[model samples]
Target: MYLDDPNRKLLEIDTDTRQGPVIFRWLTLGMEYLIGVILVALIVSVSCNVVGRALFNNSLPWADELARMLFVWLVFIGAAAAFSRYEHIAVDALVRRLPLRIAHMLYLLQHLIITGLMVVMIWGGYQVLSRSSGRSAIMDVPLSFISLSLVLCVIFIAVVSIWRMWVSLNVIRHPEREH
Candidate 1:
């Protein structure tokens, strides 16, 4: 089923203040591409490692550990990328049945809760990164560097959430073209 709504609310908030949407779009796209590349690399590396272990009786020592770390990054980065598109799962069945104005308010309240959650995530992730900066038990890479995904991902989510809020408030206009 499809809804007839134009869904400008999200885009409107993102496009507010001219420079806002541009920067947010760039950041979202950048992170999406970064996550895509990392995910593809992880898949290839894992496959090669498994094949080598089975066929050649030899395995890349770093591959397994690196792939695990990348999996963590993949989840967070993909989540952030998805957030920009308003693709995260939501239970709109009940809300959708309400009157338009009531539904919109319900949606607004829901997003506000989500915005708060994202803020907490960003703040908590930063603390985690700071404490793990010098800690690395696997692969000698700084744990903080790998953990930086938490910070990057949460920041992107927060930005998009705030932008969506602005759009709802009519403080920004939707871009004429779809992203």
Candidate 2:
């Protein structure tokens, strides 16, 4: 559960607030660990694929498929994690020109939109998983497994976003309690 020290001392020195939402913090750390695992898997799979094809003259049939699948999972999950850290790509030029209150409102609207989109994605992923049950063939794995990745990423996004929304509301009401 304790993914790493997270250098609490640095956080204390860099910001006024000393604590963060525990679940959001843990989820971000967990996803970071998952990304590391996915990277290692990718490296190993590519290495095996290259070596098998070049040196042994025979490639692993499942390597490419598995790597691609993992890559998809990594991308979606990484995006959710990055969202938690406020690291997702955005065009904030206009927002920067606005007053503080307007900019915060726009940010809230954006988070709400993201939440709705993630909900739709979760529903669509469930439908796809249901329809593809027992019908997918990717290196002998069902497509539902891949579909689950979307569901998981969307769920994480929803939880993290909702938590952020709550914190934002609280901070808006009590400007002294931000973290």
Candidate 3:
């Protein structure tokens, strides 16, 4: 459902339009909330570390370690959430100039690339997770904990890419059947 604007540029698909099955919508919302929570934790950890050093001339090593871990999770989860919302960068100027069918083909190709990369990342993450037997120096948390974030988010991204490919295929097959 596109909102018509007389002055608007042609072929600008509204990415803000959230359309997906209930589970995906839930996952997107949950990931967004997770990102917010992680950000707050990251801020708090860094702030405490700063205050400890500035006010007491002592810094907690755990705070720094926690902050780093939170930052890693934030980045990976944020990426997945952004991908869910179609918030990633794209060269839409060129795609907009093409026929709708051709554009769908391009979208399909893009998603296919993403899916392939995600698969590779998933395998790599698994390898790292399996191989790493070490723990954080200060926190004593398993190093695999950090690598799991990559595996989880990449899995989500891959699923979203597959979903996008399916949508593009449908559009290419039955343009008139689009809602």
Candidate 4:
């Protein structure tokens, strides 16, 4: 049961700064900045590789590996930043119509499921990170470094989900107050 917000286009997610805990705000802001840095690095690496291959007849071997790593980081951190902002798609019409307690109950359940899934992902990512020992063939970068991105993002999402659950509980407790 999910749909894009009506004020938004069919595929768009919210980008506005939401009121949240200080730490969440700080973390989300940091992630957003890091996404920019990773994206710039990815572009530079790919551009260097393309220019070297196209104009010089020689490719930068390390560029390909670096680009791949940066791309993975870009995606994972972007996901975490979006999740923290509550930018993910969801249908809320029914919840809006429901009684406050019932609406919050549904939100609580949704966040519980999200947090549970994130925990499972964290466990799996940790397993993969711990078991892997290989390095990038060209750059010699540890393979586990890339895997850590997923784990870190999942952890951040879980924390945000838990915080959302707390907000839901607050609304459930005080039905008269508009949240």
Candidate 5:
């Protein structure tokens, strides 16, 4: 299940400094900053590589590799940010059709399931990170560093999902109050 209103702003989670949790406010800000930096870096690296190849007849091999690594970070980190904001793709038609109380129950269930999946992913990522020893050909960065992104992403998602579930429960308990 997803949030009911598709027209609502995707990143409109309770990030207000005055009314929202301080930790979540900082987390959202940090993730936004990081994603912006990663996007700019990805763009610059790809552009430089393309220009070098076209104009100089030589390419920066490291540029391709760096771009790839940056892309990995971008996707995972972006997913975490999206998760925090409940912006991921989801089909909420059935939930939206149900009574508000039942719909919120479904939302709580969905969040718990997501939290479970993220926990499993974090565990699997840890396993892979421990076993991975290879380095990127150009950057010489350990493979574990790349695998760590999965762990980081899931950690953040798990936190957000759990928080959402808590909020959903509160809403369920106090249907008259706006959460």
Candidate 6:
């Protein structure tokens, strides 16, 4: 069934390569593992809170706060991973229908817009991280730690987007080699 689809090859090409510096590759892998750990921690915290509430008539207050922080980390890190993988949700019907050159141009434009947004996010996150003095009630962890996730996620995303944009430019220059 997959063999019959003309667009299957394009999809495969889109996802085929890992494009980035060696450091970026290692960092991405490390983030992936961290994401896994955060998810597991979230699950365990929530489970313990629920079980404790059900059986012992009391819940761990810190558990809820920990789960919330873990979830935020999970989402931001997962978003970075998805951006690196080109796995983010996109409405690409127009790009898919356009001629190859136009599509490539649009793809590059999209990357530029995303990169700009990431830069803005990084700046804003940094401001928040530096200015905020609040701490979590239960754990006493600085709220800046949570905001740092945003800064880190955007930094990762911006780097990956820049790398992909370079690859896109190369594809435009040598369209024949793309396949």
Best by TM-score: 3
Model 2: per-residue Cα lDDT over 1-179, one tens digit each: 74322211111111124245666677777888899999899989989999999999999988998898889889988887776666656666676666544555565676688789999998998889889867335477887887888898898888766665665555456545434
Off by over 4 Å in 5: 1-12, 16-20
Q: Which ten residues in a row have the lowest lDDT in candidate 5?
A: 3-12
Question: At residue 121, what lDDT does model 5 achieve?
Answer: 94
Model 6: weakest 10-residue lDDT segment is 4-13
28-53: candidate 5 lDDT, tens digit per residue: 77888999999999999999999999
Q: Candidate 2: which pairs clash? A: none
lDDT of 6: 0.77
Candidate order, TM-score descending: 3, 5, 4, 6, 2, 1
lDDT winner between candidates 4 and 5: 4
Off by over 4 Å in 4: 1-18
Whichever of 2 and 5 has more TM-score, that candidate is 5
Give per-model TM-scores. Answer: 0.78, 0.80, 0.89, 0.86, 0.87, 0.85
Clashing pairs in 1: 13-167
| TM-score, cand. 5 vs. native | 0.87
Q: Decide which is better by TM-score, 1 or 6.
A: 6
Better of 1 and 3 by TM-score: 3
lDDT string, candidate 6, 67-160, tens digits: 9899999999999877665567777667767766567667778779999999999889989998999999989999999988889899988877
What tens-digit string does per-residue lDDT give for candidate 3 at 71-97?
999999999888876667755677766
Residue pairs of candidate 5 with colliding backbone atoms = none
Measured with C-alpha atoms, the lDDT of residue 7 in candidate 3 is 15
